[model samples]
Target chain A: MQLFFQHLINALQWGSFYALIALGYSMVYGILMLFNFAHGDIFMVGAYIGFGVATALAALAALSALALPNWVILVLTILIAMYLTSFVGMLVERIGYRPLREAPRASAAITGLMIGIILETGNLAILGAQRIRFPSLIKTQVYDIGGVVVTNKKIMIVVVSLVLMLALNEFIKRTRWGMAMRAMAFDYVVIPLMGVPLNTIASLTFALGSALAAAAGILFAVAYPVLDPYIGITYGWKAFVAAILGGRGSVKGACLAGFLLGFIEIFVGAYLSSSLRDLIAYSIILLILVFRPHGFFGEPHSAKLRL
Target chain B: MRKGLLLVVAILVVGLALSPCAWAKSKTIKVGINAPITGDIPKVGEGSKYAAEMWLEDIKAAGGLQVGGEKYMVEIIVEDNESKPESAAKAATKLITEDEVLAIVGPQASSQAIPAGEMANNYGTPMISPWSTNPDTTKDRPFVFRGCFLDPFQGPVVANFIKDEFGFKKAAVLYDIASDYPKGLAEVFKEAWENINGPGSVVAFESFTTKDADFSSQLTNIISSGAQFLFTPQYYNEVALIVQQAQELGFKGPIVGSDSWGSAETVKLCGEACYGLFFSTHYAAAGATGATKEFIERYEKKYGYTPDDVGALTWDALRLVQKAIEDTGKLTGNLKNDRVAVKDALAKIKEFDGITGKMTFTPEGDPIKCAVVVRISEKGEFEFYKSACP
Candidate 1:
């Protein structure tokens, strides 16, 4: 029972991570009809941004020779990092992906590879190769529930993910621009007919998705306080798989698929050899994609402006 | 005024061109140190550069690598590998083909040194790896060598350390299967451990990608396996998260690791819960021998930080190459022949006092160095425990 509970909590934390990033992927794919390969790199940017800000704050605190309040520094770092990295996301779209939006799919993929390399290269130049230690945002106080010492941050992660997701759903359903976005995704030719500016919608869409990625990045660093440039590549790929599995255009399906992926990965690694974890996870994605040409949540022939 | 500016530019350009000679005339012989100054393993790679730079300065102060009847000055050339395998290959190529260096040291991790090894082998340039411990790195490469012990030696040492320190009868192992160093070390430790503790001592031997973030499932299974010891011969980030999550899962047993655990950042990321964990490494700051003490004093005076295993191995590697160069007694002519001579001289090295210990290479061209044990403190520092090597 104890082992079962621990594994379940483990699944929940991992699932929360999937869900957080999957929302951005699904939303961006829904709006842009573009496979945003740079999304993961943007997430990495978010983590680094958070690390830089936090390190600075920590340094200042150290210089003062007095312990600063942990919560204040933590919240400030996450928010500042999210804002800065969101701008980076905005810049990525403008510099990397936007110019290639009208180009060939292969061109965009190549651009994505370049962006990934650039972000990683920039990290190499800036942070040096070693993983920088991040200060924990949440206290590591585990609350015992059914013999599982559930970490406070994990609970925060699940709660925060739900809150952000609900908020996103509300924004999409309640706002006028959300309706315009939905219409645009259905057909951009009719978008100008509906008096919706495509460029404005596109930027807004990237901004929203990037903001969410920033949040996930900060949360991820909280649970695992080691920041590196390449860390986001794996998560980005996994979350992308999750988005596609749930149906790339469908937010609800994305969340469901992400949770499903998390469950499968955790259970397999726990029950089977952890060495084979990646192989199993990727194989599952392949199987699903092979059968379901349209992702579990995404529609077939989903087309939108890529960049 | 235009002619005056042009003439001024000409004189300045000529002066700048001849300045290398001017600098060289100051009695400094350039000791080219090429490593991943930027990119994924920069901590380890930069440590290599730092150690080399510090050692070169000391050697220059103490009459640099004394070649046959002459004392040459030392200058360090640091390069960036950017963490890509091809980039590492390029760096080695540039350092050898273009730079025509006397000796080269680094491109730190095993994933990197493989390409660097071949590059050095082709050019007959003697290159030393500070911490790239995969035995295959130096397996067939005559000119490539290392100063620290390889993963095979480290594996048994860590296994024994855990078995004795934690009184662990059984252990669970997890590492990247793709990495030669991690897999080789895990295999050796598994055999040595099972031999002593009997069969079925390994409860859950799992594998994962080095790039993975969620290792909870593996840690949970290890905890459930009733294993007293946990071994993760993985990279620092994954190991930190594994340690953090392992403690969170309520398994407070001693976790053992390889030399990759030498970084202070790894321990800080793992936090307070990972205290008391032991790892096998090359150098511990405590119990310094006279030579090591001098090296430490010189390094601290130069770089302003205490030397870790990476730093120590780098110092030794550079010194080994310099020793080989001195034995060759040739400065410029027939450079290829000089390179081969250096390679031969490097192999002839036996029981030289290194920063870690007396280091020598086997016939396979792999360095034989003593492995030391260090335990993590509650304050997140590595405390020297004991040494374990033949």
Candidate 2:
């Protein structure tokens, strides 16, 4: 039972990353009806940006006149990294997707993949092939409740992810921009006719998704503490699965499915052979998708047949 | 136009006919270095390159290698393997056939070395892998040799070390199933442990694929299995995550590692979490004497950091190649005969005293040598702990 709880905590933390990254895929697909294949690379870029910001802040903290606490540095690093990485996301959208808005959807999807490769190789070319160790911002503290073990970092990661998810939910549910986005998701062609700026909404959607991915990247670094150029490829693909499993453009479903995927993966590995973890976990997901073809929250006939 | 074409064909034919004779008469002996310079484990390639360069400097100062009564210039041709098995084999083919090197130095990791060694053996070229410890690398290939001890030898050394040091009975192993080196070492360690403590003594044996950053589930299983220690034979990148994750999961037992932890980046990336942990390696850089100390001091002075086990073993491998080349008495100007002579000389060598340790080559071209257990000191240095020998 204690072991089960431990696995649950592990699953939650692992799922939080997928949930955050899946939100990017979900939001962009929700607004534009195109899969942002470069979203995973955006997550990678966010983590590297976080590493840079944290390192610079730590250096500044070392000075006698400009001393700052580690927690303050951590907060500043996350905010500043997210802010900077959002610009990167917006730039990618403007350069890679904007011109292809009228072209074939397949062309835009291919552009996303090309952009992802460019970001990966570009980071590799700039940083070289060395693995950068993420700065340890928070000291890890382990707590044992009964027979189950948890760490302060793990708790902080879960809380921060949930708080961000709630904030995003509220923002979409309450704000004027939120209404515009929903209207756009409902019918992008007619919403633009209703005095809604298509470009601004698209850019805003990308910015919001990238910021969340940046937060996920920083929190992942705090837990894992290792940074590399290709960290986003596998992770981005996994989160894309989460976004699909959650149903198209369903925010709450995406979050729930992200955690569900994590729980299934962790529990499978914990109970069965670790070697068969991915094989069995994805097989179960395949079965679920087989029955619910449109996923848990997707509307029937909502996927328009453009051809 | 017909006369010009005829003249060009004649010139090309003469150039091709005279090339081999010209190459044979050349006074320089080329040695090939096949290293992973730009791929996953670039640090291993960097170490091999630096060590080879340092060796070349000494040769240059002495006016090149003295063979028989003549002094011949030595040249090293480095080919990047990109840390891939296919690339390694391709690099070896290029080095042996195109560069026409007398001996080849590295394609360090077993995944690369095993394939590259086959190319060398098929072409009848002598090759030595400085850091490959898998038995199959030199199993049936006479032309292939290695500087480090094999995994079968290392597994028992580590198992016995744990048994004597802590007297721990229950053991747990976590390794990368996708990698050849860790997978082979993990199985060997499991067998060695079970042999000592009886069957089912290895309480938990878990594995994950490459590039996996999370090991919480596997570590949780290992912890709940009532195992006393954790053994992971993964490389430096995965080592940092595994150790940190293991500690965070409330694992209190000692986490031991294999020689794959012998990279300068391990301590740099792992930080204080790896301090006081132990791993078996070729040689400890913290405490040394005589030639080994001099080599370490010079290398550190030049490279701005202490050299790791790969650097040390590479130096020994290069020196071994040099000794064999010189032992042949003379280069016969025929590339084939010189290569044969070098191979024979290498086989005839009885004992070699390397910076790592004294080594005696077996018929299979592996060294009978000692493995040292190094403790990561508080200051992040590889401190020598104890030595275990075959």
Name the top lDDT candidate. Answer: 2
**TM-score of predicted chain B versus true chain B for each candidate:** 0.87, 0.94
lDDT of 1 by residue, B1-390 (tens): 999999999999998788664334334444556676655556666677778767766786887667777777676778778756788889888877766676678877887788888888888888887778888788888888887787777877877777776677878987877766678788888888887789888887877766677778877777778888788887666778888877777776777888888875566567776687778888887667788888878777877766778888887788777778887775554557767788888888876877688866688877676888888877677888988876
In model 1, which runs have C-alpha deviations exceeding 4 angstroms?
A: A1-5, A52-84, A94-116, A301-307, B1-34, B62-65, B70-75, B83-86, B330-332, B366-369
Error of 1 at B284 (Å): 1.3
- Tens digit per residue, CA lDDT, model 2, A2-78: 88899999999999999999998988888898899999999999999999999998998887456999999998999
- Listed in order, the DockQ scores are 0.55, 0.69
Model 2 scores what on Cα lDDT?
0.92
Root-mean-square deviation of Cα positions for candidate 2 versus the true structure, in angstroms: 3.7
- TM-score for every candidate vs. truth? 0.88, 0.94
Residues B1-390, candidate 2, lDDT per residue (tens digit)?
999999999999999778873455479999999998877788899999999999999999999999999999998989999888899999999999888899999989999999999999999999999999989899899899999899999999999999999999999999988878999999999999999999999999999988888999999999999999999999998999999999999999999999999999999999999999999999998879989999999999999989989999999999999999999998988888898899889888889999999999999989999999999999999999999988
Clashing pairs in 2: none
In the range A208-289, model 1's lDDT, one tens digit per residue, is 7787888888888888887788877889888888988888778788788888889888987877657777778778778988
Q: Which candidate number has the best DockQ?
A: 2
What is the CAPRI rating of model 1's predicted complex? Answer: medium
